[model samples]
Target: MLFAHDTEASLAAAAELVNTAHETPDGLRTPADVVAFVDRWSYTGRVAGDAEELAAVRAVRPRLERLWHADRDEVVELTNAMLRETRALPQLVRHDTWDYHLHAVPPEADLAVRILVETGMAMVDVVRLEELGRMRICAAEDCDDVLIDLSKNRSRRFCDNGCGNRTNVAAYRARKAGG
Candidate 1:
């Protein structure tokens, strides 16, 4: 694996969070939506289940999205800011079929803070390895999705939500018509 299993999971979760901001129409417009998202990510924590929690998580999405195009120094600064803001203190704990892994906050911390700390810890691994480039924006011309390129050959160039397939089919049709 390009990174620890949990790191990869965190990265995927972070991307999912960002993608939610780009969702059609309503787009994560409620606290219940936030709760459902946390449940889907298996995030264990205290959620206010109110507008405050929803706003905090929505705020985090753009910051995490910025990391996709940031330089190493910028990424370091942002990651450190996240750690500082959340007051993260890494502790190893085993839970739910998982072996020992870092948990920087109590399982009952605020949902936004917990999500920030977890994602920051995983980003620490990426920054340390100078592999932040693996965090990328989609290559599709009109899409703003973020993705992690974990492929050994670094061949992943688009988000998994069908943009790549659509782009490929359009290119193929263009070629056939020009022949």
Candidate 2:
């Protein structure tokens, strides 16, 4: 694997969290949306299930989204800043069928802090491995979503938002018209 299993999973969740702020219908517009996101991500912690909590989570989307575009050094700086800003303290712990993994913040910390710290921990692996290029935004002409190139060959370009299929269909139609 390009990274440890947990790191990859956390990175993917971070992308989803950032992307949740976009797309039609607004995936995180309400308290219900926040609850849905927590359930979807399987984030185990104290969730107030209130508007204030939702807003806090939304506040960090920009920083997480920035990681998709950061260079090696930039990622390092951001990761370090996140770790410092959150006042994280590293601890190895196992819970809920999870094998030993680092949990740098208490479970009762703000949902945003937990998510950011988790992402920061994953980025520690990314920076150490120099795999910042694997984090990327969709190359689809009209899509703004982000993704991690977890494919063994690093061939991931467009996101799973049907962009690949849509692009292919458009190209095929153009070819047919030209012929």
Task: Give all candidates' CA lDDT scores.
Answer: 0.88, 0.88
In every candidate, how many clashes are there?
0, 0
- Model 2 alpha-carbon drift over 4 Å, by segment: none
TM-scores for the candidates: 0.94, 0.96
The C-alpha stretches of model 1 lying farther than 4 A from their native spots are none
Worst lDDT 10-window in candidate 2? 18-27
Clashing residue pairs in candidate 1 are: none
Model 2 lDDT per residue over 1-179, tens place: 87877788899989888887668876788989888888877788899999899889899899999888778878889989999999999999888878888889999999999999999999999888878888888888898899988998889998877999999999999999999
Q: What TM-score number comes out for model 1?
A: 0.94
**lDDT string, candidate 1, 13-91, tens digits:** 9998988888785468999999898878877757788999999889889888887878999988999999998889999
Q: Which 10 consecutive residues of model 1 have the lowest summed lDDT?
A: 19-28
